[model samples]
Target chain A: MKIKADTTVCIGAGMCALTLPEVFDQSEDEGTVVLLRETAPEGQEEAVRRAVTLCPSGAISAS
Target chain B: MSDLTLPMTRQRPFDPPDEAAELRQRASMHRLTYADGHVGWLVTGYAEARAVLAHPGFSNLAEKMHPPIPSRLDLVEERSRRGVPRGFFLRTDPPEHTRYRKLLTGQFTVRRMKALEPRIHEITNSCLDDMEAAGGPADLVEAFALPIPSLVICELLGVPYEDRGQFQEDSKLLVNLETKADDVIAALGRVTAYLHGLIQRKRKEPADDLLSGLIEGGELDDEELTGVGFLLLVAGHETTANMLGLGTYALLTNPDQLAAMRDDPSVVDNGVEELLRYLSIIHLGPFRVATEDVEIAGNLIKEGEMVGVHVPVANRDPSRFPDGDRLDLARPTGGHLAFGHGIHQCLGQQLARAEMRIAYPALLRRLPGLRLAVTPEEVPMRSDMTIYGVHRLPVTW
Candidate 1:
């Protein structure tokens, strides 16, 4: 399992695409995080590492 | 040695200021005084208010912070005069608050607040059908928590719902802590001259909302689109109409969490994240200014000192909410800073959690014997403002 977000430490605060929308999504023109899956899918890796610890701007990262 | 001043007021209208939970149980930073008496630092735990709101060496400019009232230094001298765009980047910090929070974070997304959840369930059933045709003992903070986020932030900032009674009397004299600081800088310069005449009528008629899609995209100018439409019309309807009037007075004074959220309407999205973590209503939480020297949670923050944080004692920090003063609508209420934490967090926090999950289960399943017309010690509480909440709730079925 490996994932990433860091759209330059995303401040969109979308809370990692509103809590793991199948491995994050956003950016309808700069709302930030849009990493839609770098790995986690089968059994959604603990809901993409709990949406990377509910990203209050740590800008997600799973490994 | 007794001057802790900054918003440790409540004295229990739903808790949180037992001198900020006894100064976050005596550690997570302390020394306080401001209101211009100039003594700083306050934090109050939840990991020192998320390490001074995710420190970029803590600084949100206004002369490196500290006026948590002293009429917020007349709203920082009425947003420092010429052109007024600083009134809210939650008071600017990063790279000029990273270009007006990247153009208001694509106008608040979580798929645009879940496609504004069916127009927030048809504006919460037409404000519970105007509180059931104004019959039973109403005043639910003026017919349903100030017109359901003031008609969904005046239809998401196109404004003109008959100019919402002069922008709700210029956002109630710019948030009423007994007004006067030159009448809150003349009611925030009459909401910045009514958002600079609605951004010059959305640049000569460009409607279809969010200030005509920020004037059909030219990357903001007219004083940064009237300072992002006066900070989304006063932080999008005064913090979700004071979190739907103090989360319906803490669920009509917690009658079994309002009959377990009106008999499990799937606990209305963990009962709106446990009523935004047990009504942590925006209480005096954003101020910082260490911009050169810092060291959090184990003290020593110097360079031009001042910090405030406090958000209802860091969202009731019982070491980050394990039974943090109980309001458990099925607990694990995710990391509550109640729409604040890092990078000036709370760009309409998912449209204020989709207007409190569609206005608290449609005002508890359309007033199924709603209850509370007074007597939770006669309601009142906006603890002389700066946003605590419950200026008038008064309900009934």
Candidate 2:
């Protein structure tokens, strides 16, 4: 399954981008939050879940 | 326990019932000493909760005492020696509180709150977009809950929103008891010092924001201006951070409530109110010392005894909110103590409400089927902390 990130919740602690750079990136201007994935990679479902689960702000989710 | 003198009897800063049942089972209230024998009262009943909060006998200034301009004051002596005002009005009574509060009031008027709705919506949507593109289950706290208000409050105050990441780190240290008091105090000194500079700049170039307006008016002294800015940042960020975590936890756990809001977007307003009341994340508010000997709920409080009005209990009081346990979107009241009451009520409440109202509906609609990826039992809750919330609220749609 693919997902879209909930960026408003991002404190830009930069943990998600650090953990999964391929799928997530921090915004250059605001250092707010940015997501490279319009949808998750086919085999990366568990890793994506880990990114969501580990978020301290509870900002991200999957659809 | 010994009848220890309240080393810091000072001024600072809710409840109810089937509340009777809940009160009976409440996380037992105790009159304990904090950080060196500061004697304060703790009330858990909903009715008395409001009464104590609104009570006049309580004092807010900690470093100052009555009659005993002794060689040493209590909790606040060091801070005052360093020239910090007794503390934020979150610890004050009117008319002094009135003076400090007035400088910041124009920012929280209902009309002002109403105006922020659109901007709050803009911030909320931006955050929702970031979360959506991440793909799969994610920690709602790190990803969405914390930043939404960080963006909203920073924008409202005209602080660089991006700086929150670093400010948040310093904030954690500032609020952490385990951190060296000196280091934490130093962090606070830095944040306030920076805010003072920002307020100075705002005076020269007024923006259409609260900080600039407050600074340009020249009503708040440099000390109060510094203090207010810090309060806004700490209170602004800390409380809402918990609200986002706990509110989402409530929704994710209560599938029916989630579905109801999902089906009808308009319910978001009431849902937000109920969540604020129910969660009441900022559990222990400012400590108020008894300036004069006073009595609360039949207990004779001696002069200089420390006490605080716990909000979760007050907001949950049955008199103020009947059927308090159920999270009803339809119910409304005189107000929720969640933002607090009277002169010292939260100045940033409107901003907090605006952020929640916008965030919840946008989140629900965009991620229509949002649900907990983990069972409620598996999810970690922050029981040890005074603010009731989870470390993370893992969700998926």
Best by DockQ: 1
Q: Report the Cα interface RMSD of each model, rounded to 1 decimal.
A: 7.3, 15.2
Local accuracy of candidate 1 as per-residue lDDT tens digits, B65-137: 5566676766555544432455366667667778778877877889988888898788789888977987788
Q: Residue B254 CA error for candidate 1 (Å)? A: 7.6
Candidates in order have lDDT scores of 0.78, 0.64
Off by over 4 Å in 1: A1-63, B1-23, B27-42, B45-58, B61-89, B92-129, B133-143, B146-149, B152-200, B203-223, B238-240, B254-280, B291-300, B304-308, B314-369, B372-396
Task: Kindly report the docking quality category of candidate 2.
Answer: incorrect
Residue A39 shift from truth in candidate 2, angstroms: 59
A-chain TM-score per prediction?
Answer: 0.30, 0.82
Best candidate (score: lDDT): 1
Clash pairs for candidate 1 = none
Candidate 2 global CA lDDT score: 0.64
When superposed on Cα atoms, how far off is each prediction in RMSD?
A: 23.8, 16.3
Error of 1 at B252 (Å): 1.8
